[model samples]
Structures are given as C-alpha cells and as structure tokens.
Target chain A: MGIHIGVDLGGTNVRAAVVLENGTVERLLQEKTEPEQGAEFTIQKIIHMVENLAEGRTIEGIGIGAPGPLDPHRGVILNPPNLPGWDEVAIVDQIKAHFSVDVQLTNDANVAALAEARYGNGRGFSSVFYITVSTGVGGGLVLDGKVFNGAQGYAGEIGNMILNPNGYHYSNLNKGSLESYASGTAIGKRAYELYGIKGGSEEVFDRLKNGDEQAQRVVDDAIEYLAMGIANLTHILNPEVFVIGGGVMNAGDLVWVPLKERIKKYLYPELVPMMNLKPSALSGDAGVIGASLLTRK
Target chain B: MGIHIGVDLGGTNVRAAVVLENGTVERLLQEKTEPEQGAEFTIQKIIHMVENLAEGRTIEGIGIGAPGPLDPHRGVILNPPNLPGWDEVAIVDQIKAHFSVDVQLTNDANVAALAEARYGNGRGFSSVFYITVSTGVGGGLVLDGKVFNGAQGYAGEIGNMILNPNGYHYSNLNKGSLESYASGTAIGKRAYELYGIKGGSEEVFDRLKNGDEQAQRVVDDAIEYLAMGIANLTHILNPEVFVIGGGVMNAGDLVWVPLKERIKKYLYPELVPMMNLKPSALSGDAGVIGASLLTRK
Candidate 1:
C-alpha cells in the first residue's frame, strides 16, 4: 500500500503525519505555525516537516486541511479569517513544485468529516454529518463515503443557519445564527453576561456541574439551540449518523442527554429512530487523518 | 433513445405520460383517482392507464410518483396519510408482474425535483433543490442529475423544519414548522382568523392585488417565513439553483420579488451572488415528468 502525508495547518500550529492506506498514522510531528513571519516562512516549515517525516519512505501524495473560504479546485488559500498574511497563497502549487507528488487541499471541517467517516465512529455509516461546536460551529457532510461539496464548495456551512431571527446580532453573520447560540464563544459570552464572569466554555460547564443556577440556564439554552440546529439538518439530509466533535462536546452527558431529548421533540415520530447522534471518535487527530484521505479522491 | 412511462398518482387524480429519453412528453393522459374504491382498484386503474399509454409501443421502463411515507427501495406505498386505502400496497411488484418491465417508485416531491433538474430551469445546473409551496411545502434534492434519497429515503422533508418554536402547533408536526406558516392551507386558515373570511390562497392574492391591507399582511408574513426557510436551506445545502413550483408560485412577482430580497439578508456576503432561485418550468406535469426520469437511474 502507498504511504501518504497529511498536514493540519492552523493559525497557532502546524502538524504533519505519515499515514498508511488503512488510515493508520505511522509517524506524526507538530510545530508552531508562526504566521507572523508570513506565508513563505510557514510554507517552508511545512515542506521541511514533510521531508523529515518521509525520510527514506516513498510518499505517493500529500493532503492539507486549512481554514477555508479557500478555493479547493484552484488549490489557493484565499483570505482565511484566522491565518494572517495567507491570502491567495498558491499552497498546492508550491508544495507540488517540491514534492513531485499529488497535493490536495480542502477546508479543515471537511477533512475532519472525511477522517471521521473513514476511520472513526462513522466507519460503518454510508452518510454522515459532522458538526464541530468549538469557537464557531461548523459542519461537513460525507455522503456515500465522499465529501458532498455543493455548488462553489460552500456546502455544510451549517453554523450560519438561523435559529432565531430576533436573537443576537453578530457583526459577521445575520441575527440568531446557530453559531451565536451553540458555539463555545457564545457560551462564554453568555456566561460573562449573566454572571459577570469572564471564562471559557469549560468554566461554564464546570459551574453547571457544580449546580450553579445561572450557569445551568446558559448551558440549557445552548443545548436547546444546538438540538434545534441538528433537527433542522435531520429534516433536510436525514444522514445515517450525526458525528459531533469540538471542545464543547467535552461537557459530555451535560450536552448529550438533553440534546437527544430536545431533538426528539422536534423530529417526526417516524424519523425519531433514524436520528442517530454520536460523539466524534477521532478527537484532535481528525484533521490530519482526514487530510490524508483527501488524496483518495 | 428509448421511450419510458411516468405515472403521477394522487388522492384525487392519476396522470400518466410517455416520455422520451431527452425528457420530452410524447403523450399524456389524466383521470380521476377515485382512491375510495380501494388499493386493488387503484392499482388496476394504474395498470390500465400504462397499457393504454404504451399502446403497442416498446417501452424500456416505468416510474411512479406516489404520495409518500412509501418505501422506494421495496416499492411499497405504506399507509400514506392522504390515501386511506394505501396500506403497504405492493404497487411496484404488481405492476412489474403485469408489464415485465423495470418500475421505480419514489415520493412525489422527489420525482418532481428529478423532472425539473432534467428538463426545466435546472437543465444546465449540476445541483438543484426543488420546493413546492401549495397546500403543503415540500422539497426534493437532485445532485448530479440524480435524486439524493438520504438514509431510509426520507430526505428533503423540509416542510417539517421548525421556524419558530413558540408559534403554531400542528397535531402531526412540531410547533412552528415551516409548513405551518407558508403552506396554502395555513394561508387560508390565517386569512379566516384575521378577516373572518374563509378563502383560499388565490383569494388572498386577489385581495392583495386589489390593495386590501389585511390580505397584504398575511401574504407578506408568508413570504417572509418562506424566505427564511429558503435561506436556512441555502446555508446548509448551498445548491446551484433552487426551483420553486406549486399553486402559491402562481402569485408570481408578489412572492418572487420579496423572496429574493429577503433571502439575501440571511446569506453570507460572498454567497449572495451564488443564490439562484428560479421558478419551476414543468408546472402541473412535473410529478409525472419527474417520475419518468426516475427510471434513468
């Protein structure tokens, strides 16, 4: 079987892994992205990492997952919001110029979805909708073992879905977007507003576990909106399984038990049995693992 | 270059058409369904219509679009709410036994989507999401010229999507479902409640054209909610084009102009140009025409 290299590129860090055809990570390494130094510096760092990982082993292809709004077809990283000085960089061309092998690029969420569907909890599922509820809520759909990219490669932008037209107004998005209520950023903001405490989503979950009434209210609202968003996707896609990942899911039963109950209330009686929600099995490595599978295309 | 037959079965009427491979209707006929006569009688009537449509001409396959909750895989019409006598009726097997030809069965909305994707405004588009906003709001997705039937064949049940949790509650569906606010039946009920006038959606439009303020309010509300529903789908699926049909669309500019303007408010700035909403071209014959295309699978 051929060997492959997978790269998970983010604003804060860069990671690369050598993976086998059977979706196993053979060797992995991580380093700071240091985006302040610019795209050329970052690109060289990535190439160096891949070269070291490849060593004497023959690598057939390389796949990279980047924060998106990038053109996957053209292989250019457009102006992604998180990574500074990485606008319209020909990452694919630059990497391919040195590697002498295929290089594929896709959105981070999309690669994670592919990884989960192929190697994690969704391995047996033909259709999977993967949702990440961290800093911002994002999602990707894997249908029939392939990423279902809609027109313009902008499908699965589920976080932008409206949950309440009259709710909070985010400057970047419309009022009451799903992300405004369910994302980790939203939870932290709500907790700060209600109790005048500046803390992360983990802090809010801790307060809830300690039976803080205000914290409980904040978490309950997030669960309700998240469940509503999931139910809406169920109506449209009816995927075999919904694989949820992200830092917020670390709340575990505090989110899952109530979320499943809320989802049932919104779904059709007949569709209740079809609504299968599972926690993502790959955790932090999903990005690199999924990036590797991009070469399969 | 082969001929196929398409059947559109409804509670009140049955329509069949001979369709060419290029998606043209060669010959068409319609008659009362009289479903009260029972499932066996309806099946026999359908067989008779197909025989007449064939008329000694060689046909490669047949496709039937039925009111759903039906099993497309097993080809069974399972206890649809509208068809009282259709309880697990093996329509496909019975028809195939008589004609010895390939027969495909799918939900009415899905078949309509298929027809529109093949022959209507979606002809040049790669992905199309078709929506019908008449007595009820229903939708179907056609991706790469094929109907995307998700897990258990219940995909595209967009009517069941909730727009407002505290709004109207239907006995069969969750509160504030899109159908509760946008369907023709909902429009009529709202019209009666507001003005004490029991009238159809056409009457409401007529009143709006004549400058009745109450009628205008009802329609404007419907248009707003419909746009919200479309915008929700836009954020999730991001299809190339959205083709809308059904009796409500007959209001034309009253719905189209506001729907387009309102949808823009909810979409991402970059995605605004990609949102293409078109009126359905096949009109009343979409069901039958789309059914015929199902055999293309």
Candidate 2:
C-alpha cells in the first residue's frame, strides 16, 4: 500500500493532505494561496506544505487539482480565470524537481468526480458522471474508474452545453447554456428577477419550502432545466450513476425528488429504470482525495 | 500481422469481409439477412459466411457490428427495433462455438467509428466523435482508439440529445431531439411540410442548388440545428476531430461550409481555433473494416 499526497489548489486557499491507500486521510494542511504575491510564491508555499506533511512518511506520488485551461499532459497550468498572474506555469515539473516524486495535474472538478467514483456514492460503479451545481455548473466524467479527459483535457465542459439556443444569453457561453439555467448563480439571478428580492440559492430554497408560489415557480423551472441537462447527459454517456454535489444540492429532497421525476420524463423508457442519481458523500474533501488517487497505480 | 473476419449485420442484409492487418479488404460477401427467418437461421447464415471467408486462410478472431440495444459485453443481440425476433440471442457464443476463434460484438455506429479512428481520417487523433447523418442521426465516440461504450453500452446515443424540448416531437426520442432536427429523415419531412412535395434529402439538396427558396430555407434550418447539435457535442466531448459520414454529407460544401461557420458561431472563442472537423474517408467500408479492427491485438 502506497501513501500519496493530494493538493487542492483554489484561488482563495491551497489545501494539502496525505492519503493512505485505502482512501483514508492521514494528515491535512491548509494555507492562503496569496496569488497576489505571484506564481513563484504560490509554488513555494505548496512545496513547503507538502514537505512538512511528508517529513516522516513514505509517499509514492503527488496530485494537484487546479482550475483549468491547463495542459494536463504537459503539466502546464494555463491562465486560469481565478488564479491571477499564474500564466503558463509548469507547476508539475517545478514540484517534481523539488520533491523527487511523480506529479499529476487535472482540473478541480475532474478530481472531485474521481474522488466520488473511487470512494463515495459511486464506489461500486464503473462509470459515473459527477455534476456540481454551484455558482457555475461544472461536470466530471469518470469512466472505468478513471477520468475521461478528452482531447486537450476539455472533455467534461458540460456547463457550456446549450440547452436552448433561443433562450437567455450568457456572456461567456452560448444562449441557454446549462450554466444559465441550472446553476445556483442562475437560480439566484432568476429568483431576484422574478420577485425583485436579491438572495442566494439557499434563501430561494427556503422560500419554496415555505410554499411561496413565486419561489416555487423559479425553483421548479431550474429543476426542469437541470433535468433536461441530466437527460441529455444520460443519452450521451449512459453512466451507471450521476453523483451530484455543490452548495445547491444541500436542498436535499427538494432538489433530487423533482429532478428524478423530471429526468424520467425525458429519458428513454428502457433507460429510466437504469438511472442511478445520488448526492455526493465526500463534500469538499473530494477534490483533494480524488487528486491523490490520480497517482494510484 | 493477422487476418480478421468482419461482419456487418443490418436489418435487410448481412455483409462479411476478410480484412488484413493493414485494413485492406481481401474478400467480401453479401447476403440478405432475412431476419424474419428466425434467430437460429440468421446465426447459421453468419457462421456460413465466416467459414466461406476463412476458407484456406488463417484468421485471428471475428467481429460483428449489429443494430444496437444489444449487450456488447455478453455478445447478446437484444430485441433491436429492426431485428424483430432477436430477443437476447447470444451471438458471440453461437459464433464462437461454431468456429474455434474469439468473437466480439459492438453497435454498428461504434464499429464504424472504430474503423474511422483506426484506419480512416481519424488515424492520428486520440479522440474522435463520428456522426452519420443518414435517415436518422447516429453518433459514435472513439476515445484513445476505442469505442467508449457507457455503463450499458449506450454511450454514444447522441441522436437522442435534446436540442429543444418545445420543438417537434419524435416517437423514439424526446421532443426536439438532435435527430428530430438534423437527420435526413427529418430534413425530408420538413421539406415536404413546407412545399407540399414528398422527396428524399438528396432531391431537396438538388432543389436548393437549383435556386428554390423553399428548399433553401428547409436546408438552412436543418444546417442550423445540425450545427447546434455539433456545437453541443463539442462542448461536452471536445474530441480532436468530428468525422462526419452518411448520405447527407455528400452535399459537400453546401453542408460543410455552412456547418463549419455555424459551429464557429456557437463554440467558445478559445475552442474555435482547436476545432478539427473532417469527412469520413472510408465511405461504406468503415463498418466492416472497423468491425475487423476490433479483433486486432
């Protein structure tokens, strides 16, 4: 059994953890990313954190989950939107040179999906499509226990998939993108527009539970679009399970029940019975743990 | 180098071929499937064809491309819509029992994609999404030189992907499915509705070329929807290239030029430069050659 190091590199913070072969966390460390100090400083901080964590341990390899537009094969982190001033940094090579260990890099969402597929609700499934309905819709596809990174490592960019090209237009994506309809940000925005009350997705869900007609309408609409996106995914991927995560999924049954019912309306009759939709079990630790699993044989 | 036997089993006919390791067709045979003759009769016909092809020759294995909804893993031909009585027939077991060679089965579209990826225009690409725009739109995803059969071997059913939930209804798929908008069957039906004339897709293309306004509108609408579907596929899969085949693609520049331009309008700017679209190079031979390639070591 080999021990591995996993790093979740986010815009606000960098988290590192030492994980055992059985998917157990041995030690954890967190620190501010401080991207304002530039790429060199950030890289140094990550190296120091990993060194401290591995001081008395035998580690096989390291995996880092970062925001994309990255060249995973070349180990180069391209200009990610949130990580300012970190343009074209060869983070894997730098870390490998410093630690004398193998390093692998993938997008954060993909790592989270890998985590779910390997250790969470999708543990026994051979294929899993993990979707995060947070501020923005993000997806990760795990096929045969491995991340299915298509050409250029941009396979699971499902947020940009157009749900209705004639619907509302988003600046970054085409009209009626899944992100514009199903994401928490989209729900919040739509809720505010309809009721003239600005609130997050949580507040909207609360209002729906209290039987607010307007809120119910807004949430129901989002659920419908979410189901549409999931149905489209089902037709394309036919994964064993769809493991959903993110802040909005915290609404629990309010989200899953309607979502499942709506998905059934669009799926192939033969496929409706095969649909296995579940909530994420690992929460925030999924990215770190999944990243570490990248180095696993 | 090994010689292989490839069988293409369609509703109306069965085609078998002897293929060399280099993807060259050495011998070919064609016969009516006559599926109404019963499953045992069809199995015997396939066995006889394979024996004829393998006479005085050494072969590695046999590969069959059949209408889907079949179990590729167990090699069982489920009751596909076209093959009326093919109710869970173990095609692989029967073929293997008759001949002392391994046998593999996959959906027809997937095998065609494999042929394109391994021996056609997609040879050097690591990922390929092959779409055939015949009577109904069908898709096959070849990732890392293999078919990406999802959990139940239903991975590349892109025809069922929804383009508009509010648009025209199709019995076999959800309302406003990609197939409903872009398939040849859909195009011809729309042309008939618009002009009160019944004609095939090729006749519509000819009318459009001959400066018929109604025909132009019908073809343009189809092109727009097809481009939208391709764009959605691009966002989700981001394959290295999109290899298009089938009769509708024979319209050449009228289809490809407008399609390329329309897809560019929907794709992310960064991804625009990364798009590599091409036409299938192997013509109708892809299915047989691809099925044979399945037996390659």
Candidate 3:
C-alpha cells in the first residue's frame, strides 16, 4: 500500500496529515496559510508543510481540500471568499513541482462529505449531503459512494444556493441563499440587528436559552430558515443523512432540536418518518480524512 | 433486444410509448389521468394506457415517471401536489398485476432527468438537473446516469425549494421556492398582481408580447426569479445542463434571454464561464423517453 498526505487548506490554518489505510492519522502537522503575502508565499508554505509531514517518508501522492469555487480539474483556487488575495492561483502545480507526486484537489465541503460518506456517519448510504454550519454554511454531496461534481465542478456549493429571493444580493446565487439565512454570519447578522449587540455564536446561544425574547425570536427565525433550507435539500437531493458539522454545532441541541423539529414539519411526511439525522463524528478531523481520500484509488 | 414501455404521468395527461433498444419509439398513446376518481382508478387508467401502447408487442418491462412524493422502492404515490387524490396508490403493483412484467417507478422529474442525461440534451454529463417551468416548477436530478432518490425516494422535488426568507408558509418549502416565482401559476399570480388580469400562462405571454408594460414587467420579474432559481441550481448542484422545459419555456427567448443574463450575473463568477445552458430537446417527449429507461439493467 502507498502512503499519502492530506492537506486541509483553510483561511486561518493549513493542516496536513499522513493517513493510514484504516483511516488512522499516522502523523499530523499544522501551519498558517497567511495568504496576505500573496499566492507564492501561500504556495511555499503548503509545499514546506507537505515536505515536513512526509519527512523522508515514502509518500505516494497528496490531496488537498480547499474552500471553493476551485478548479478541481486544474487544481486552482478561483477567488475563494474566505481566502483573501488568492485569485485563480495554481497551487496544484506548485505543490506537484516541489514533491514530484500526483495531487488531487476539491472543495473543502466535498472532501468533508467524501470522508463522512466513505468512512464515517455516511457509510452504507447511497447518497449523502454533508453540510457544515459554521461561520458559513458549506456542503458536499456524495452519490453512490462517490463525490458528485456538478457541471464546471461547482456541484457541492450548496451554501451559495439562494434561500431568499428578496433578501440580499450575493454573487454565487441570486438575492437569496442558504448562507444568507442559515450561516453563522446570517445568525450573527440577525442577532446584531435584533439587539444592537455583537457577539459570537456561543454568546447568542446563551442569550436565546436564557429567554431573551428578542434574541430568542431571532434565533427561532434563523432556525426556521435552517429548517426551510434542510426541507429544500430533503426535497431536491433526498439524501439519507444530512451530516451537519461546523463551529455553531458546538452549541449542541439548542440548534439541533429546533432544526430537527422544523425539518420534520417541512419535509414530506413519508420522508420525515424515514430520515436519519446525525451530527458529524469526525468534527475537525473530517477535513484531513476527506482530503486524504482524494489521493486514494 | 428486449423492448420496454415508457409512461409519463402528467397532471393533465397520461402519455405512453413503446421503446426499442436504439432509443426509438415504436408505438405511442395518450389518455387523461382522472386523478379525481381516486388512487385505484388512476392506477387502472395508467395500466390501460400501458397496455394500449404495448399493443400485444413483447415488452420486457415497464417504467413510470410520475409526480412525487412517491415511494420508488415500494411503488406507491403519496399524494403528489400535481396529481390530486393520488394517495398511497400502488402504481407499480397495479401495472405488474395486469402485465406480469417487471416494473420500476420514479418521480416524473427524476425520470425526465434520466431521459435527458441518457438520450437527450444531457448527453455525456454525469450530473444533470432538469427543471420544468410549467403549471408548477418541477425538477429531476440525474447522478451518474441513474435517478438519485433520497432516503425516502423523495428526491428531486425542486419546486418545493423555497426562494425567500419572509416567503410564504406551506406544508412543504417556504414562499422562496422557485415555484413561487417561476412556475406558470406563480407567473399568473404575479401578473395578476401587476396587471389585475386573471388568466393562465398563455394570457401572460400574450400580454407581454402585445406591449403591455406591466405585463412585460411581470414576465420580466418572473424571468428574473427563474434566472435566480437557475443560478441557485448552478451554484448548488452544478449540473452540466439545466434542461428548461414546461409551459413557461413555450415563450422561448422571451424567457431564456433575460433569464440567462440574470443567471450569469448571479452565479459564482468562476462557474459562470463553464455552464452549458440549453432548453429541453425532448420537451413533451421527456416523460415517455425517461419512463422507457426505467428498468434498464
């Protein structure tokens, strides 16, 4: 068996792991993406990080899970919103040139979805939509146990799918999108508007739990939108499980309970009885696990 | 090669065709689906339509494409919105009892998606989302050349995917649904709100063409929403081709032109360049063609 390296390229951090066949992490390394210095600097950091992780080990290839809209076919980052100053950067070519190994690239969400479907909660399911509800809502779709890349490789960018027609203006979608209503950003925005107080998701969660009427209403509204979004997914994709991860999930049942209730209310009654709702088991590990599989057969 | 019979069960009509191996239709028949007569009667009508099309020819199996939420595994129609009074109808069993042939059933949208991917405009594409802008906006998703039925076989019901935040409330998706903005009923609704005229899609199209400014505006707004919906599909599903069908597309470029432009403006700029947007080639024939491929090994 050939050893492989997986890298999760995020706006804040670049994490690389050496994954064994049984989905174990043999070794792990972390570094900053620091994209402010430009694509060349980021590319160098990625190359050095991979080299450090390999450490003279017999590494067969490397797989990268990056924030999309990425050119997976070309291994280029096409102006991701989270990563500033990166515009169609050819990171794949840079990494391949340094290591002389094959590289596979995909959206971070899709990789996370692949990981969950193949090795974690999504196992045995023919179709799964893996959503990460963090600072932003991002997702990946797996069908028949493989990643589904839609036309032009933008298939799993569900966050960009508009949820509100008259809500706001966004580039990825029209006036409304799931991200506009369900993301942590949307929730925070709503909370800020409701109370004129700014705080992280945890603080808001506490306020809502304490029955701050305004805060509770805003949270309820947001959850309603989340349910609406999930209902939409239930109707369109009809996946067996919707694997939700992200920073907001740390709030636990405060979000999940209402979300499940709303989803049940909105989904087809027949589907509601058969749906399997689960939280992410891999958590932060999903990125590395999913990234690793990209290099697998 | 064994012959197969295809059936497209529409809200207004029931269409059936006998299909040969080379994707050719040998015999065609049409009938009205008197869904108001209840589930058993509708099932019998479907059976009669199939037998009439078969015309004593050797058919290996039968495929049905109907409006959902239907149970494809058990072959039951669970009170779909389009087909009234079709509650828990055992369509596959009903057909099988009469013909003694293998039977497979799926949502009309999903089957249409299969038809397009395999034998129509979606040729060579792995994932295709087919949206029909008719009396209501319905859709089908084809993944890897097969229908992608979700956990409860209720996948590809895009009409229920909400489009707005403060959108309307219903048993399914919110008012933000594409159906709320782009479907024929919605178009007429919007037109009525704008022009105070109560008519169907034909009147809306005629008034827009006859230089009625408000009517044109209503049509344009609908197109804008349609584009946004398509843009959402582009970003979310990322399918190669969004095959536009249904009564709304009958207006042709009147809808496609502005709709295409809006999608270009709203979609992820990176993805904007790689999409292949086309109207449906099969059109009225999609149901029959899709139904024919239902049981292919």
- In model 3, how large is the Cα lDDT of residue B230? 78
lDDT of 2 by residue, A49-134 (tens): 99899886777999999988787888889988779888999999999999788899999889999999999998999888999988
lDDT of 1 by residue, A149-256 (tens): 677667888888877777876548768889989999999998898788687787898888898888888989989989989988988988889999998898889888
TM-score of chain B of each: 0.96, 0.96, 0.92
lDDT of 2 at B176: 88
User: Candidate 1, which CAPRI tier?
Assistant: medium
TM-score of each: 0.95, 0.94, 0.92
Worst 10 residues of 3 chain A by lDDT: A168-177
Pairs in clash, predicted candidate 2: none
Q: lDDT for every model?
A: 0.87, 0.87, 0.79
What is the DockQ of the complex in model 2?
Answer: 0.74
> How big is the positional error of residue A206 in model 2, measured in Å on the Cα after superposition?
1.5
- Best candidate per DockQ, number? 2
- List candidate 2 segments past 4 Å from native: A1-3, A56-59, A84-86, B1-3, B56-59, B84-86
Model 3 segments more than 4 A misplaced: A168-176, A209-211, B36-57, B81-83, B168-173
Give lDDT tens digits, candidate 3, residues A1-297. 568888999999989999887788888888888878887987788788778887787778899999877888888889887798789888888888888888989999999999999888888888888888877788888877778876567876777776766675434444557777777777777778767758855667788778778777777876887788778777877788888888776677888888888788666666777778788888677788889888788
Q: What are the per-model DockQ values? A: 0.71, 0.74, 0.69
Q: By summed lDDT, which 10 consecutive residues of candidate 2 chain B come out lowest?
A: B194-203
> Model 2, residue A8: what's the lDDT?
96
Worst 10 residues of 1 chain B by lDDT: B165-174
